[model samples]
Structures are given as structure tokens and as C-alpha cells.
Target chain A: MKFLCTRCDEVMKLAGAQAGDDTVGLTFSCPKCGGSFAMLTNPAETTLVKGLGVQVGGRSEPAPLMEVIQSSVARDTENQITWDPGAETRLANVPPFARPMARKAIERFAESKGIRTITAAVMDEARALM
Target chain B: MRMYHEVAGDGGSDILGQVGKMMERLAGRLSLIKSVIAVASPKGGVGKSTVAAHLAASLARRGARVGALDADLYGSSLPRLLAPEFIGANATRGEEGLFPIAGVFGVRVMSLDYLTGYGARASVAWAGAGGSITRGPVEASALRELLADTQWGELDYLIVDTPPSVGRLGDLTALVPSLAGVVLVSAPTLLAYQVTLKSIERVRALGVPLLGLVENMRGFTCDLCGAANRINVEGEMGETLSIMGVPALGALPYDQRLLKPAGEAGPIEAVERIADALLAKIGGHAAARA
Candidate 1:
């Protein structure tokens, strides 16, 4: 696949998924003014899988965090949080503190990239459980 | 093989199983990029965002898949620095979410400013009341929401720009799993330098790696050769940095070319050289990955 750099208009071949995410580096310098620029060599958004974990059911479980991204998936994905509106009741059974953390984590999952808020929630939830 | 419903209608193990599946899917996306480095400083006017933008740009220039995210929720400066000229309210409107304004060079960019209608984080200040921004004390979830809403496509580096403070709070960065390091920007001013040290130690205490230190506006430069020597000054910036142990990335002598845009007028387009200098110190791939 070919990825066109938005900066230099340089067309570099997108190395295969197996080739590695570091292969495609950015080079942005305007040939005219020597104004160079660059961006990261992104990975195959569709084919790759990043690990995400969250505590659930009294045990820490791996959670699917930010998934389904494309050159197309922009910040708007938060609007589609897909919260099971009534899930609040199910969330009730969780401890008062874990409930909040769970709520926040779920909201984060619905809104941003994956697992951004887990470290804190996991700790807080672990503490609450204990 | 357990199927979970996206709707709240059902409960039981199905919910747990479904959540697991969902997290598994989301993890797939987060895995694409190994690190999201945020450069920050607590006191404003210390060039925190400037260091962040340039470092990110430099990394991108060096062949890394980088996404420059301005997370200084209240002080986002990347929108203007990266892609200015975008005046439409729906400028970031896209099927996915807010679209980062591509700069003179394309670095997949996004800022909280893009989500709310503004060029920087100031807009969100009024828009999101004290506790209503999203939910919880952890802002990373809101950041994640911002990330989920935007179309970042893909990036190797997501160099985040943050408010100079103690740390982050979302599921992604705010609550961080791990970090490559934290680039704390400071000046030679004792107060700034001390705070920078505190931030460095704090991040390390939290387990986040300290990439190194960047002393901005270290001193003045000679007019003729542009050498960064503190003119008529008693001590050098690097002299004090030695005892700190953290690698002094380099001292940015008050370069008019570099400081002008990031000053009262805000990020100017002529500071690419500053970006280059930062990238060089980041060590590129040559710096053995620990």
C-alpha cells in the first residue's frame, strides 16, 4: 500500500504489516524553501490489535480499548459512545467507588483512544475492592 | 465465544463477555502505536507547547508515524502552530470526529481546541464548567473521547502537548499504562528549574520514564556567530544541569527565530529549526530503545 505524506506530498510505499510500524517515517521539507517536515510511520489501523486491560468481575481482564480506526476515524467517534443507556442499573451492583471508575472507563472507551484512563481506575478500583 | 450486547437491555455474563470483546477490539487500535509522549511545563510562558510541537514534528521528520496531540485542555496551542487559517466552526467536522488541521507539513494533528470551537484550549475553559467536561477527575477519558472522536488515522508517535503541571488523568495518557518519558520544559530561572525537577521526579516516581531534560531560553546568544553562551553571565545552563543526572537534551539559547512565534504572538511559522534541534536530541532510532 502507498501512503501519501500530507506534508511533502512524498509518496512512500506503506511497508507491509509484517514489515513493522517503524518502517514508514515522515520527511517534510519544502523543496523550494528547504522547509522540511514529517509525521510518524503509522501502522495498519485495520489489521493491528493493541492490548487493553481493565478490572472486571473481581479480576483484572483485558478490555478492548480504542479499536476500529482508519485514516477516517477522527475525534467524532466519541459521540457514538454506544453506552447501553440502561446499563447504569447493572453498574449499580459494583461497589460505589468501582462504579464510578467503571463508568469513567466505559465513557473513556466510548470516547477516546483505548486504555488512556486505566492505570488510575485500576488502582482505585483495586483499592475499593480491598 | 461469548457475545455481549452494546445495549444496556441485557445483563449478566453477557455484559462482561461483550465488554471483554470490546476492550480486545479497542486494544487492537491502541497497540498500533507503542508510545504517546507528552511534553509539559506547569508555569505558562515557559515554552512547554513549543517544545512539544517541535519535538513531535522533528520525530515525524525522522521517519516515525507520529500524531501530535495537543492535550493542554485549557492551553492548547497546536491548532494555531500546526494549522492556523481554519476558521470554520465545523472545521473539524468529519464522519469520525474533529479533523486536525494539517500544517505546512502533514503531521496527523488534533487538539481539544478543535473539538470545542476555538483555536486553543481557552474555549473549553468556559464551555466545560468545573466538573462537567465529561466525567471523573481523570481527564484522559475526555482525552480519549477526543481521540475517539477525531480522525488520527495512524501514527508512530503521538507527542502530546500538555499544561505544565504534575501529570495526566485519562484512560490513555491521564491514567497512562507506561510512558517512554516525560519532557519537562524549564528555564534557568531557579523557580522554573526547580519545578521542572519536581515534575521530572514526580513522573519517575509514578513510573513514567524520564526521556531527558530540555532547558529552554538557557541564556543569550552571540549576535555574530549565534553561539549559545550566556553573555556576561556568571554560570552556564548546562553547568547546573550536570548534577541533576537527567541528560540535558540541550539548552535553547533565546533564539529570536525560535522564541518569536511561541511568544505573545503565539506559534509562528518560522521556528522549524527549533523543531529540528529537538528531534536531533531525541536521538532518533539510533538511540537504543530501552
Candidate 2:
């Protein structure tokens, strides 16, 4: 089967597939743009390539790509949150991995007080609440 | 007929090997959005899209930046609900990324209707005829990219309107693990309520917060006699959801005025009422965040 690059319209063929196998790895550099794209195939292969072309920096080491990806996923399990400048500085006391959770806690604290902005005082209150 | 050739060995030979990396990349791209909320149902015709569109509009109205992401790949209705002009065209692209089309009240929107090249109107026709652009795991991954690739700017809220399908819900949860919450939309009918309960269970199993349940089209009002009566559906929906620990957001009565053309003004009053209650909870949660 063939898959099209959603960005450059470059077509890449799938490596031979075994019968009844629903999944397959498809990778190709779109000659048109010299950008790399990869995917595990499914019936809707076209949509999977949502205009993303991984810009390959100079290839030196075969990255433990999967490992890097796994670590990122594990980290993302914690919510990424926003913070006001004062509140963010206050979060310096919190651990890096725990900052996201702390941010959420602070926002909730602010919301309770009908506070839209998270100042240092709000952060102090949030820390107590948490 | 081949415009391009396949590389013999590049990247990973095992196609399934890239799923994790793909998901990781996607999550990284979408990290900027503050809150991700999905409006879902277990069955169709439950007014899920209407809820999502109006909720987003309401959020935008409250002086917060907002975006509406239509995740219904097969039957996208956000374009029509929010920005009808974008119905047959693709969202414009820029050097930064694909710009989400600004719709009514400045709400950014991204949908398959704006992404597919197959004339958005034509695609809807095909979807209505029981055709889909893709299926299975690929569909899930595609949705991840859709959300990741759109340049939503700094949004305070992103309302994801999803189709009523088990697989579609899986796709959303897989892509958005940090989702703030999910609002299950259902009619006041027993059948709709039961189906919504199953959806609530699935969302809970995934660990995404359940914001609440919204009873859409709750009761019909008589125009002539000004009489209000609950729809023939029988069930204590609020009590049912409350038993499961999910708050009832409030019911939106059916209104015939919604069927009339509103044009550029966005969704009807019914949807807006639900949106108002939802926003209050969101606001209250921040104040009462545990």
C-alpha cells in the first residue's frame, strides 16, 4: 500500500505486509521537501500524516527514539499548566516534576477567591490549600 | 501511476513502532492550550456539536481566548455552527502553522471540514452516505496530529466536539491525556441517559475528570399556550448522574427558534444556556480546586 505525505503530497510505499496484519511501519523522506515523516499504518493513513514533516537535524547517533518518546509520555502524564510571573517564582520551591500539579492547585485557589491572576500571595494561599 | 518511490529501509521497519513517538510529539505540540474539554455522546443526534460550539462561544464571550476543535472526522458540524463560510474550504496556512479559522465572536476553530481537500460540503455528503476517510488506529493517530498541528495561539479553553463512537472517544483520550474534563451531552430520554452513563464510565476509567452531564432538549415549550412540558422521555437524569457523582450542569429546553437561520450570530439560546452553566462550574472549580 502507498501513503501520501499530507504536507508535500509525496507518496511513499509500505514495506511488504503479512496477511491479516492491520499495522505496518511507514517511513519516508519527502523528496519534494526533504522532510522526514513516519507512521504506523491504519485504514486512514492519509489523515495520520497531518502536515507534519520531522526536520532531521544532522544524524549522528541512532537516537533511542522510542526511549525518548516514552520518557516524554511519562512526563506528559502530569498536566502542563500556566502560571503568573509572581506565582511562577513562588513555585521555585516546588520540585520540577510537581510544578504542573502545583500550578493547577494554584489556579483552583485563585478561582475560589474569584481571582483571575495568580500573584505571589495567591501562590502562598494555593500552597496552603494543596 | 507512481509519482514517488518508497525507500527500502528507513526509520523503523515495524510500522507499529512509531505510535508512541507520534503520540509524544503530538502531546508536546498541543501543550500550550490551557484546558482541553471534550463534548461527547454515546449516540448521535444528542446535540453534542451544538453544546461544544456554544460553550466555546460562551468562553470567548467571557473575555477569555478560546478554540473549538471538531473531532468528528466523518461528520463535522462546527464549521456550519460557528463559521458557515468555511464549510467548503480549507483553513489558511501560514509559516507559523495552520491558522485556526476565526469564527463568530473570535473563537478559533479547526475541523475535518476545514482540513480535508475534498470540498468540505462534498465530504459531509460522503460521510452521511456511510463513508469515512480512515478507520482503526490510524484514525486515532490522525486526530492527534490534527489537534497538535493547529496553531490555536494561547487559548484559555479548547472545546473538542467528538462523534458518538467508542473508537472516537478512545482517540480523543489517547491524544489528550491532560484533558481538564469531559461533559457528556444527552437528551432527557432514558435511552440517551443510559448511553451517556456508559460514556461517563469510560471517561472515568481513563482518569479524565468528569465536569458534569448536560441534558439537552430537556422539555418542549408550547408557543400558543405558553405551556411547558417535559419530553415523553421518562427518567430522573439529574439524580442518576448525581448518584454516579457527576454534577448535572442543567437542562436546556427545546426551542423551535433554533431551527431558523441565525447567521453569523452563532448557536441558539438553548446551547448558550448550557454553556453558561458549564462556564460557572469551570470558574467555580478553579475557586474550589482540590
Tell me, per candidate, how large a share of the native contacts it keeps: 0.00, 0.02
Q: Which interface RMSD values do the candidates have, in the order shown?
A: 19.6, 15.9
> What tens-digit string does per-residue lDDT give for candidate 2 at B55-134?
77767776778889888877888877776644544444443455677676778888766544343534422111112433
Task: For residue B206, give model 1's deviation from the true position in Å.
Answer: 2.1
Assess every candidate by TM-score.
0.54, 0.62
Error of 1 at B26 (Å): 5.2
For each predicted model, how many residue pairs clash, with residues at least 3 apart or on different chains?
63, 6
Candidate 1 per-residue lDDT, tens place, B1-290, comes to 12233223232123456445544444544566666676767567888777776666555655677777777766677766554543222222443344555553456667655444222323453212223322232244445544545556676667778765765522344334544556767776767766666666666666655666677776775889977675334335465556766666655667665633223343333334544544554455226554
Q: Considering the true interface contacts (CA pairs under 8 Å between chains A and B), give the fraction that model 1 also has.
A: 0.00
Among all candidates shown, the one with the greatest lDDT: 2
Q: What are the per-residue Cα lDDT tens digits for candidate 1 across A4-119?
A: 33454443332222323323343434443345444443433211211121221112343222222121123333333332324544555556323334544454443344432234
- Runs with alpha carbons beyond 4 Å of true place in candidate 1: A1-130, B1-26, B62-64, B87-98, B119-122, B126-138, B169-178, B222-241, B259-290
